[model samples]
Target: MKNKKFFSAEHKKYLRKTRLNRLLISLGRWSVLLFIIGLWELSAQLALIDPYITSSPSRVAKTIIAWAKDGSLWLHSWTTLYETLIAFAISIGLGSLLAILLYLFTPVRKIFEPYLVVLNSLPKIALGPLLIVWVGAGTKAIVLMGILICIIITTMSMLQSFVAIPQEKILLLKTLGANRFQVLFKLILPHAIPDFISVLKINVGMAWVGTIMGEYLVSQAGLGYLINYGGLVFNLDTVMSGIVVLCILASLMYFSVATLEHYIHKKRNL
Candidate 1:
């Protein structure tokens, strides 16, 4: 009975602490955001900063609402979202497959590893004109840009995870008469699940960056295009509104990956 009571108290304490931590995190996040918004509004109202140059939260909100009423907001947002999702899916599929191939074949890895590093290090912006010349200014160029940005990182990260797996396990599997395919499927892939999830989380942001950069170069529609147009017209509020929307969209995508990671962890634990 004493042990049962001790366990019960411990469980309650754990629950309380967890709740407190979550509350603190939420409060801190909102507090910082609110402080920044308040300061921006105050500065704008006082004319300490020109609202025309640096739009306030209110101006951004108004611009978003105006766009929404005109129906252009959804059109541009959907265009960007569609391009990003397509690129993201393709990058994950191609990257994972290529990483697996590289891991299984030493010669392939050796031949391409240096090239991957060089490509990754090269500034993507420099390739914009070439891409335009190759694919023309459209969705294809935008999607390809995002794929270029995300695929190398995914391959490098997953290849590292594959290489990091314990050699002893592979040797043991071989001793048990497990063939290469069996070892790869049952051991390497399972061990790399967490790494795959981490890559997804990171690629979400990289995909957005690439897509936005591409849109700036070639898109007739998209949040990035809106920002570019706004800048050309000196519409700071519209630019700020596009930036705000991009932030929210990126946050939502990140949280979706985090949720998937949580589900994966729960399944693995079970």
Candidate 2:
């Protein structure tokens, strides 16, 4: 009974520590958010900048809430999120496959490496007009644009991770009678998981960028469409609201990737 009581006390202490830590982290994050919004509100009130162009935090918040009540904001957010998720899935699936192929085949890598580099460096906005022309105006074109923006980066990052596995490890696997296919699947892909997560984090932003750019040129829905419409009509509050929503969505995606990265690293270390 004494030992049981001691164990219970220890568990309670651990729970308390975890709660405290979570609270501290939340406070830090919220403090930064509040500080930025406070500064923006103060600046606008002081007339330090034109509120018409720059907009205040309060105005942006009101605009978002207003759009939300009208269903426009939620609908647009859903459309963009759907397109982004679909593109992200395609990018990760195809990019990782291509990376593995290139990693395994010297001839394939030699032929495609330069083109991959060029494609990665190319401005995705340049493809906007062409994508709309080919895929038509709407979610499909936006998803395609996002996929193109992300695939090259994911390929390059995952390929680098695959090659980064130590040669000694490969040698050891070969001595164990593992064939090329077995070695790649059993060794390289597992080793590349952390890098792949990192690549996904990057692809999230690229996907957003591509989707937004595509919307600017095409599409009748999305936060990007809202921003374009806002600018055309000089509705600064609407534009600022769209920008805020984009920031929040991107940050959330990045945070999710970071959590996955942490989990992968912890498992690896253990």
Candidate 3:
């Protein structure tokens, strides 16, 4: 009974220490954020910087609140999110299919590799005018931009990982009577899982970049449009609010991808 009580006490102490560490970490992160905002606000108030241009955190917060009350901001945010998700999904699906095709056919892979490298090298924003002419404005253009950004990156990343599988492993599989399909599924695909996760993580940010750039170039709606409108009208607060919202959204998407990466890593370890 005494030993049991001692073990219970030790477990409680460990839990307390873990809770304290978590609280400290959270506080440290928030403290740094608050310090930066406070410094910005102070600079603006002291006339050391142009508040009209730079804006302050409090002003941005108020602007967000006003937009939230009106419902326009949420609508724009949703439009951007929808376009990004659609493009990301299409890119990942098509890229995976294309990667498999490349793996299956040596001639096809050779023909496509140069094209992919050249396309990836080209400035994505430069295609804005052509895309607008081809696909028109609004969601379609944005979705196309996102797809263009992701497809090449995903294809290249996954293709490299697919081909990087050890030759000895492939030989072993073949000797064991595993055919092309079996080798692909059991060997190449499993080896490419981590790379696929990495591509997903990268595309989360790249997709957002493409979506916003498309919107900035030509869009009737979305956070990009809001920021452009704010800039035109000199509504610094509105611009700052849009900036904050974008940061939050991008961070959330990044965190989601990171969580997925962690899950895959853990699963693979097991």
Model 2, 101-189: lDDT tens digits are 89889899999999999998998778888887887877888888889988988999998898889999999999999999999889988
Q: Is candidate 2 or 3 superior in lDDT?
A: 3
lDDT tens digits, residues 212-234, model 3?
88889888888888898899999
- Sorted by lDDT, highest first, which candidate order results? 1, 3, 2
Q: Against the hidden true structure, what lDDT does model 1 obtain? A: 0.94
Give the Å error, residue 72, model 1: 0.9
Listed per model in order, the count of residue pairs whose N, CA or C atoms clash below 3 Å is 0, 0, 0
lDDT of 1 by residue, 1-270 (tens): 556656777798997899999999999999999999999999999999999999999999988999899998999889998999999999999999999999999999999999999988998878988999999999999999999999999999999999999999999999999999999998999999999999999999999999999999998999999999999999999899999999988899999999999998999993
Off by over 4 Å in 3: 1-26
- Which candidate would rank higher by lDDT, 1 or 3? 1
TM-scores of the candidates in the order shown: 0.94, 0.87, 0.90
Tell me the lDDT of model 2 at 241: 94
TM-score of 1: 0.94
RMSD from true fold, candidate 3: 3.0
TM-score result, candidate 3: 0.90
Between candidates 1 and 2, name the one with more favorable lDDT.
Answer: 1
User: Runs in model 2 with CA error above 4 Å?
Assistant: 1-29
